[model samples]
Target: MANLQESNHQENWENLSQKTNDSLIRVRKVLTLSRIILIVFLVLLVFLFLPWRQTIPGRGTVTALRPQDRPQTVQNQIGGRIERWYVSEGQEVKKGDTILLISEISQPYFDPELPQRLQEQLQAKQSSEAAARQKMRATEAQMSALDRGLNYQLISAENKVKQSINYVKSDSADLEAVRQFYKISQQRLERYEQGYKDGLFSLTDIETRRLNVQNDNAKLIAQENKLNTSRQSLLNAQIELDNIRVKYQESVAKAQSDMGTAISGQATAQGDIAKLRNEIANIDFRLGLYVVRAPQDGYVIKTLKAGIGENIKEGESVATLQPKEPLVAAEIYVDAMDVPLIGDRSEVRLQFEGWPSVQFSGWPSVAVGTFAGRVFSIDRVSSPNGSYRVLVKQMVPVPAADEPWPVQLRQGSGVYGRVILNSVPIWYEIWRQLNGFPPSLEREPKGDGEKAK
Candidate 1:
């Protein structure tokens, strides 16, 4: 029974070995077929998509990141020991936001005690102006009084002349009356003397007549002399009045003119003082060398090798500012051979090595990729090694960040970019030659449609 069992076991083992061998052979064949299929597939993919196929003509492209158009921030205008900071590092600021305060120290045009001195000077000027105004008023009052006095003096002189003339006229009239009375009395006395001599002897009546004739002769002589003296007095008074009136009118006119001149001089002085005050104020504002402000609602970048107590020279860059919108711009050098291919308004295709399959192209980006943008400009001169440099603007929204703009524009972010030259036609050289001008092509006269070079 043991021998029979051994025989059955050997046969079973033989059958099992055959089945195992057949299975191994089939597996080998399947593995060889699979290898062939994989090779064929790989070869097909290479032929269809390899760059060497020359489906499109392109130069080796240089990659770079887009740069910001505006600078990170404007430097401070004033240089001094920062007295006080009005804002924190990352603070949102408006157009006219005050970023910091500098202590009012002595500047080029500043005195140590300028503020106090200015105040004192202003007060003194105020007092001086007031005093000057008061003096002007007093002078005007005096001038007015003088003018009035001169007029009165002239009037008095005229009145005196008039009185003198009236006296002269009365004297003349009295003289005339006295002469007439004397003549009439003499005629009557003569007649009476003749009648007395021819008639009877009346001694008392003759005596009375003689006394009247003597009195009339004396009165006439006195009246004539008084009239001559009164006429001389009237002439002297009229001459004095004429001279006094001329001098008074001249003095009054001069006084009035002088008052006006004084008032004009005071006004000019006031205007000059005001202009000087304004200039001083302007100088005060321009006293500092630098002005610092918040940069785009962001934190101050304090990475500079400077300290608060350090003395900074003029035009020295103290600190860099970080803007809210951070971008990573890579500057790459392109060869001269490739420069002409890349120009303004070209489309660039970008590939991220980190995200192998991800790409960026065109104005509107697709699939979490940045868009292509026009070239901002190209350096007129090439690099020292004859490599050309071109600056391009990238159409990409800034990546979202919790930090603000000032903090985001930090130095050294890694980015890659490609500059798009153009989608050149297959017959680019021929097309350029045909469309070129001057010796190559010219516009046809009227009635002609299209012309070629």
Candidate 2:
């Protein structure tokens, strides 16, 4: 019995030793696995804090900053056949310079005698006016002469009246003398008759005295009649002078009226001539419209229709002119997925098509052959190409020596740009992508000083 118990205890001790060795091996394996997993977790944690830049890439074309101002279209102002082109494509021009000449199609078909007839009519009117003026002058001169003659006639008539008055006075004086003589002769005859009766004189002497008295009486009567006729003549002369003055005034008034009519006719003719001349001037102005002139100073970017003899309608586009001092801009189309990542005034890096350098936009310091720019606008709607439009303007262009890029970039050149977004770690990017969530910032990114760490 003692030998059996001792055997069982020895067996229990061997089993316990085996169990201990198995437990030690299992613990060793667990420690080795734990150390490996801890190392891997530490490495992943380190990667999560590493700084990385997020960028959205887009394609664009370089264009003028105000694209609407460029590519101006020149249109024809009138409909006609182009006679000649004074300027060619890509030519620079100044304001008011003649650019082309157009010819009216209906010019040759119009009546050639129209202008000549107008001119002839104008000349005829002018001549008629001249003749009317001459007639007016002649009439005025005749009026002046008539006025002078009338004045002289009036003076002469007045003098004739004075002479007639003097003649009447002289006749009255003679009549009085004759009457006194007849009275004396008659008295002497009567006394002789009385003496004869008293035997102092003969019959023949008395008869002679009577005859003398009768003759004296006849002379007195004749003198009285003559005096009356002279007075009547004076009255007639005064009436004739008054009539002459009235006639002179009437004649002068008639002459003045005729001269006024002539002057009026001359004025009408002159007005007609002026109107015809104005019409001719208007025709000349209309003819001047065949020449086309530049409205502003610019360069002709292209000619839509420059061939001679081509007919163009009014207001049709003839050419395009690009104004000087055009501004530059980048018209980019960003992917819809990346549109939310950009905003106004966001930093951008551009790479021109012909430039030979690689650009790592996430790490801009490692980039070459790229120009710096900023986002100026973000479209609220998608473009026709199923992408959002973003407008970018270049900062002060760096010199080619400073950055291996062109100092002057042409308009309409192809370009590629990257819109710099928030800075994050590569692990976060992987996590967000795996979760199917849009990119976002965990916290506000630090400045350059913190990012360098």
Candidate 3:
């Protein structure tokens, strides 16, 4: 019984000792965790409470590769097989340089027979206009002649009327003189007859006086008739003069109307000629569609892969022209969080993966030194890669009169960029005050540096 009790006591003591050691180990681990927690809390407190640099900060520089501005690509609204290439790939070109010629069917004139027909029509109109002018001139001349003749005739008729009036006056005077003679003769004859009858005069004397009286009466009657006829003739002459004057005016009015008609005809002819000329010019413009020239001076990136006699639809792209003057820029992506911090006038440092540490100093790096400039654009939308894109422009260096940037840089070169953001806002500093935690921390549980059991 004693041995049994001793053994039981010993087992109890071993169990108690094991429990004490475990308690010690647990205390040591608790202290170590407390110290670690204290250290982390101190670090976080320093960061959250620390004062930082301050200013109205603004600057973001992206690692800039040799940036290339997009090349100018020549496109066509009307497409056809390339008839001829005026320039070869990588050839230097200027503004308004003719690059390629496309062919469909070129019509120099709108109408199939327009040139000849227009020529004939123009000739006809010219001849007609000339004739109209000539006719107008002739009519005017005739009108002038008629006006002069009418004036002469009017004057002549007036003179004739005046002469007839004088004739009438002279006839009236003769008639009056005849009547006076007749009256005197009649009185003498009567006296003679009475004397003869009363035997105071001879019979022969009375007969002779009677004969004189009859002859004088006949002369007076004839003179009166002539005077009446002369008055009637004067009236007729005046009527003729008035009628001639009216007819002359009518002639002049008719001539003026004819001249107006000729002028109208000539104007109509001119309008027709202008219309035809416009049609021909339109045809020329249409024919120009068969020729495709570079829209701007650029490199030919995509060439026409069409064979001879290949059909191309209208507005189809036959080739892409990357403008030589404006270099193509690498489109670099940026993160969203970095975007707002990137202020305007952000500088970018670019490094080409293909070429690095090369001499890109001064303005010697780009062609058309004037076209090369600084970053001017940033993409408003994010890419699928969750980043924003921006365009970096290089200051183009003036070529050394002999060397250029290989007919301007080609398109789609991979580039690396580092955006430099300067003077981070007080907001970011305030975020530092929040222990680098997102503003949504209140909505989520704190990690407390441990896993949940």
Candidate 4:
């Protein structure tokens, strides 16, 4: 009995008992239990000094690694009525596989031969544009011909002007000579008449001199008329030269105006052709939209616009598709306080929904049925729930202890994730937890430390 109570304080509890051995032996177990508790506490305090891995736990969803690999909506690019369904929910389809058929719901795409008609319109406009171009070429040729003719006529007119100037100069010289002769004749006649009056010469000589003067006067008058004619000819030649230029300008201007008109017509036709071609292309694209096809290899999840003849608006979802064979990931959300402690290469332990797992959040090495992963992405901003999102990708060359993820692991399934961080003393972890502090990083993670440096 004493052996059982040996660890207890003998003076305190034993003295309180009677000196009777029977009462002492049958004493309460209060001091024994207190001693046991104290010993256990001491052992616990020593254990708290041991090293422990820090971790942050979060809830998340199972999803694809890439956004394109994720489940997505199948939509129609144009408004239409569901005519037929080529696929049903849960059916597998390949990329470009037709899922449903839709008929035109709007008035614009009603005509079955609409694209052909547009093509015909485009063809006609193209023909008109061609004709306009040909007319423009004809006008240009006409302008060139007019220019050539103007060059020839201008050269001829210039030569005529030079000839007229030369003729005027010759006529002026002849007129001056005639005036000198008339002057000499007049002086001779005056001298003869005076001698005849003074009886120095016979009346016959005076009469002959007077006749010579009249003759010289007549010649002078003719020469003056000739000079005037030459000047008039020069003036007429200049006027003709100007007329040629004006006439050529008129012809060239008419040609230029015609060419401009043809160009305007060609431009208008080309614009119309472009409009028709654009319409054709758009209609072709819209025609393709009538057959709703799967954008990727996937399974049809659900029909968004159900039933035949149901009207759907442009860009409306027709069905949902879950892509096949996606690279799956665990996406978890952690509190803002804990996000800073996460590292890009942080190890992740995932508990996928519908899968059995025995997890120790603080110690992931002994965990069972939980797959391993590493940080792949993390959102800079908080989620709607005020938690930061972190994406964890599957670990490559997986640990021999970890089993492969189940093939049946589907997207949007629930996941519980634990992001393993740096190791620290258990006491520090306890103190941190007690103080609501973030996980400790006794040493920064390899990747994070390098980044910090």
Candidate 5:
């Protein structure tokens, strides 16, 4: 019985060892298959999806080729009511073309009053000048008449003085003759008195001689009185002559002064008329600033004030104009995370709106329907959308052998592009992304080592 039990135990142990060997073989086969499948999947992923050319993608819009190529706004320089419009929206116009007409606000017929007032002022000045001239003429005539009267009076006074002097001379000569006769009569009386005392002459003869002497004395006295009267007349005539000369001089001076004053007044009146005329001319010039004209040759993009009767203020926008020809540009925005990958003059690939495109990130040579471009500028600050702005310039298209080039892009059309960056391995990119690391960790190259300084 002991031998049989030992035999059963040995057989059971051997069966158990054989089952364990089969299970180990199955486990080894399963492990080997899993390794082979993992290797194949990794090789396929590297070959297909790993990007060989790292790029930063961005979106943008088509814009004018240059900033100055954009539309220009036209404004009214003065406030007025629109009278007429010569051009409409979208119309082509040449430089200096009349664009519109504006009329000044209506007045109550007396608001300006400048023209009527100027006319009235001019007429009044003219009338005043004429009156001044007439007064001057009257003054001159009066002066001439006074001059003639003074000349006549001066001549008469001179004649009277001459006559008085001559009379004085004649009276002096008569007085001398009377004095000689008196002396002779006194001598005769003395002779008669001596003869009477010596009885050589009669008494009657002596008395007659005495009477003659007395008569001679009386005649001498009368002659002396006449001389005095003549001297008085001469003095009076000289005084009258002096008075006439003084009066004449004073009148002449007064007349000349009055004439000068009248002439100056006339000149002032004429000056006032000239000044009024100049003011009227200035008023006329102010009325010519009501018309508006185009400042340059362009096409009207939009009309801000289109109503004919609309009132517009000074410096208000009236219309928008666009140049006849304009170049195209792309305005793109890059996210903050990808902005460090872009630089000025960086290589770019753009796909326009309405155009189909296909991109092979690893092999850009096989890209289809996409145009080449370059990054022209990048914004220093983020925009309101939290993205950095970028401007791009499109390079000339090089179409495939059997493909046609894209049509011209319109302004403000949607666009998208890729900013090509430094080349990197697919595995590294994947590892970085999985670990929440940046796309690239390498520093930018400094040009000629100058940036370090």
Candidate 6:
């Protein structure tokens, strides 16, 4: 029984060996295919380790770099009615060249000779103002003469008053002397009469004494009257002096009042003259505005107002202008998330509209029909689309077939652009993209003026 069992086990082992050999032989193709796949994976990994230049793509319109170089509208400061059109649309105009001739429709400047009329008014008022000044001066002179005349009269009146006072004093002394003489004569007469009564004096001597007394009394009375007349004269002299002063003061006051009136008239005339001058100047300026001229050298693109007799309001748009020789640039908008990676003076490659181009963002050196540019400015705030605007100017010449961008590129044309950033390993970039991570900066950005050249 042991010998039989050993024989079966040996047969089973032989069968198992045969099956194992066959399985090994048949799986060779599968093992070869696995080895080929591993080699291919390793090659792909090596390629991923290469450097890749990161870029942010954007789309925008071609525009001028400077605001003044962009398209603009021409208008007048004052309102008017169009009388004639000097140039039509698409006409090339030099600065100060007349494009339209307008007439003043506003009532204030309706007169064709408005400036001349205002000038005449100004001259008339100026002449009036001059006459008033002359009158004012004459009034002042009159006032001075009145003062001198009044002073002279006051001096003369004072002298007369002094003379009257002296006369009054002399007359008083004479009256007193006359009274003394009369008293003495009366005493002598009384003594004579007593003597005559006693038959000791003659009648003729008494009569003579009486006559002397009468004459003395008459003289005294006359002297008293003279004294009263002198006192009255003194009073009259003083009154005359006071009246002269009052009269002269009134004259001076009247003269001063006349001068004031003349000055007021002169001021009014001067104000009117100034107003007329200003109006004349305004009319002159408005006359120039009647001929609407080009503000700068440009081409008239479109007329905002049409036809003769069309009324235009102040500061209304007259026509559109496109300045000659604009500094061409690309106005691009990029995602807000990608704006932080872009810095001033960053390198940009642009493909303008209507221009055939091939681009490789990671390999800019291999690009075709694209021009090199630099970031000139970036908007601080995001746009309505949650993107930021970036202004890109050509730093290098655009090798277009005919001319450069400044000459050949038209404003408002579409453009596609790529802003270049840091260079990183392709493997890392792929990983970041796969994991949804933001791009990294390999180095610090340049200063605003550092790479200006």
Per-structure clash totals for the candidates: 15, 1, 28, 0, 1, 0
Of 3 and 5, the candidate ranking higher by lDDT: 5
Q: Which digits, one per residue and each the tens of the lDDT, describe model 1 over residues 1-453? A: 999999999999999999999999999999999999999988876644422100111222223343332235445554556555555544455444565544434355446666566667666766666766776787788778877887797788888889888999899889889989988888877777788898853666677778887898899888878888888888888888887777767776776676676677677657756865876686577554335555454445542323344443433454445544444333445666566556464434433333333542222234244333345566778878787665544444423421112222234433345564222222442344478511112223444322210
Residue 283 Cα positional deviation in candidate 1, in Å, after optimal superposition = 9.1
Flag the better candidate by TM-score, 3 or 5. 3
Model 3 lDDT, full chain set: 0.65
Using lDDT as the yardstick, the better of models 1 and 5 is 5
For 113-145, candidate 4 gives per-residue lDDT tens digits of: 998899889899999999999999999899989
**TM-score, cand. 3:** 0.53
Candidate 5 lowest-lDDT run of ten: 398-407
Candidate with the greatest TM-score versus the true structure: 4
Ranking 1 against 3 by TM-score, winner:
3
Per-residue lDDT tens digits of candidate 2, residues 1-453? 999999999999999999999999999999999999999999989978876677788898877777554567877766789999988888999877888898876654256566677788899999999999998999989898997898799889989999999999999999989989999998999899999999999999999998999999899989999999999999999999999988988998888899999999999999999998987775577467788877678788888896789999988888888766566788889889888778777778888888876888457657876777888888899998899989888655543334423546667789999887777777877777699776574435467637533
Ranking by TM-score: 4, 6, 3, 5, 2, 1
Winning model by lDDT: 4
List where candidate 2 sits over 4 angstroms from the true fold.
1-48, 106-289, 294-298, 396-408, 433-436, 441-453
Ranking by lDDT: 4, 6, 2, 5, 3, 1
What is the lDDT of every predicted structure here? 0.56, 0.82, 0.65, 0.89, 0.80, 0.87
Off by over 4 Å in 5: 1-39, 45-51, 106-297, 396-407, 441-453
Show pairs that collide, candidate 5.
65-327
Q: For model 4, which pairs clash?
A: none
TM-scores for all candidates: the values are: 0.45, 0.48, 0.53, 0.86, 0.49, 0.74
- How displaced is residue 22 in candidate 2, in Å? 31
Question: Model 2 lDDT vs. the true structure?
Answer: 0.82
TM-score of 5: 0.49
